[model samples]
Target: MIPIADKYSTFARFYDAMSGEYPVYHAGRNIGISLLRQRPGAQVLDVGCGTGLNFSLLQAQVTQGGTIVGIDRSPEMLVQARRRAERNGWTNIILIQADATALSPAEIGSRIAAEGGRARSDAVLATYALSLMADWETAWANMVSLATPEGSLCVVDMQKPVGLATVLTPLAKAACWLGGSDINAHPWTAVKRDCVDVKAASARGGHLQIRAGTRRAGT
Candidate 1:
């Protein structure tokens, strides 16, 4: 069996096409980014940023003056993300290839600064990404560490669908399995616990949970 990173590396070429962006996952992203509330000149971190799917929306908010730091573990995915940035004329993007779970906060902060971004971002977002990390809490802590003291943090991840969408449970499970994610991860619970003034939203019958909030002291 292919390792999870290898799976993503191999699938990078076809990820955007097969990732169900339009009819399904887009809603959570829209809400997550909105909750970030970043300013025009602020810097934002995109953890596990595959193919830069969130770039266009983030660029619109940050404008030409702001910077977007996109970090992913897969080189193949970063290639696609770089291509997307080039094709879209997005010069403010800095792409880093690193494993979020392994890298320390200081190391990543230095890397970001070396790549022309601020050491600490004004906002950080991980969408449909953390559930894949077995040590997702470590990733979440590192994410918060990379943010400014007063920065906003947002997590958008999957869960079992509720209400009418419960009928799609099998499909959801299959998708999560294929994607190497734990459908029961509930990664957003970290944000609720560690952050203040938390905001929450659910979409696609609770299959997607969106949580955003300001970083709390000592978090």
Candidate 2:
């Protein structure tokens, strides 16, 4: 079996098209970004930001005045992300290649500062990303370290459908399997556990879980 990183690297160019963005995953992303409520100049971090699928939506929220720092472990994925930014003439994007689970917050913070963004961002987002991590809780901790005390947080990921949608379980599992995600990860629970004023939404028959809220100060 192809390792997840290599699979992503090998298929980086085709990710956006084949990622089921429009048919299934896009709804979760839309709801997640909407819950951000970021200001025009907010500095936002996109963790495990594969191919920058969230860039366009995030840009619409932060605008030209804000900065977007996109971090992903796959250099190949980052290549596509860079291309997306360049194609859109978006100059405020900063891309970093680092393992979210293993990164040093202090070091990465300095890097973001060097790029003219704040050491701690105003908001952080991870969509269909954390579930792919083996130690997603660590990644979630890193995300918290990278955001301000009152920063907004959003996580969107997949699961087996429930209730009437249970019929789609096989399809959902297949999609998660193809993408190398842990269908049972349920990473968004971190938002509910560690955040405040939490808002929740689900799409694609609960196969997609969307959670967004503000990080509890000092948590």
Candidate 3:
């Protein structure tokens, strides 16, 4: 099930503390930057982006010339994100209020055209957001719709809970309240399966990315 917007609206303030700066978000950002190749400029989208925490890192990778659009359903979260954008003087970045799953190709097409078209975005990203979605299927489908034929897509989510770490249950439960995280016991695995099953398109050819990882870069 997808999480209600209210669930995250309440936790925008303490999200970073809940995430533990060194581990969760930062780690994901590092990996994303490397995968994106830190191109001097690339149009990018951060689907389900929360509080714009990943912006600075992603911007650094894509550079000042790059464009990033961060979308989320919670205004409270987007408020924080806007604050960050102003703080960074990021004129190229735009924030939108919406669910990731609803990011249809038609919507993406219009928005991209309005924002200066040319299929500017080379990357589509989802970091620490999918696990909290109420309808992961729609969200996954929307992501497929948003990316270009050649666009690179990357996602970083918590690994599913392993067999009863009875001792860690309390800690895991606490993490959930902070940002509705860990709602999916097997988030990564489940999403990976969906990705694999999805018939997606790429610049070179039609393809699918599965949780089982049937195909991937440098493979």
Candidate 4:
């Protein structure tokens, strides 16, 4: 049998517990909401979505019938996620025990069919999870693979601020390797993708929102 947590399995169970106490949780949800405003009926994919924490926040902003998909590699985390959805009556939520670095349309299609035949999502949202992805670029590409041309790709993550983004980038890189990641890079290494960059309003004491770009026909 495979280890449930490749890099974060152990951390997954305590993720929400740690994040609940995390002061950034509030600002994080706010940024995701703000970035997703332009997309209607947005099919938001919370990549590495831990315990479906962002589902409630996105559920309200997207169209009434909108769906929110949360995918993570840890089954332990998914256990809690099942409870979160059931408790919140978040019928729109679907939690998958999968890897973020491998997210793609084909994979998502299989999962959807297993559920009930839903189409690709309008957008993808990766909160606080990008920094931990095994392959940030491929993960970003995969999320883009799941979005529609008219939809948006919203990313919410923690930053070390002006002096810190640069300083912490390498540290994150090392951590990624030790955590079983060989891609050896952070998602924001370049931000050179064809998409546009929308900077979220700087909340003095909250998470940061970054709208990288709207999905453009198979981007």
**Candidate 3 per-residue C-alpha lDDT over 23-72 given as tens digits, one digit per residue, 9 for 90 to 100:** 43475555544555547677777888888888888888777787888878
Native-vs-model 3 lDDT?
0.62
Off by over 4 Å in 2: none
Report how far off residue 120 is in candidate 4 (Å): 1.5
Cα-based TM-score, every candidate = 0.98, 0.98, 0.74, 0.75
Tens-place lDDT per residue, model 1, 1-219, is 688899999999999989989889999999999999887988999999999999998998998899999999999999999999999899999999988999999999999999888889999999999999999999999999998898999999999999899999999888899999999989999998989999999999999999999999987
Shift of residue 51 alpha carbon in model 2, Å:
0.9
**Residue pairs in collision within model 1:** none
Query: For model 4, how does the per-residue alpha-carbon lDDT over 33-94 read when each residue is reduced to its tens digit?
Result: 67667444656777777777776778777655777778887887888888988997777777
* CA shift of 128, model 2, Å: 0.4
CA lDDT of each prediction against the hidden true structure: 0.94, 0.94, 0.62, 0.62
Model 2 residue 55 lDDT score: 93
Q: lDDT at 159 for candidate 3? A: 40
TM-score, structure 2 vs. true: 0.98
| Predicted candidate 2 versus true structure: per-residue lDDT over 49-73, tens digit per residue | 8899899999999999999999999
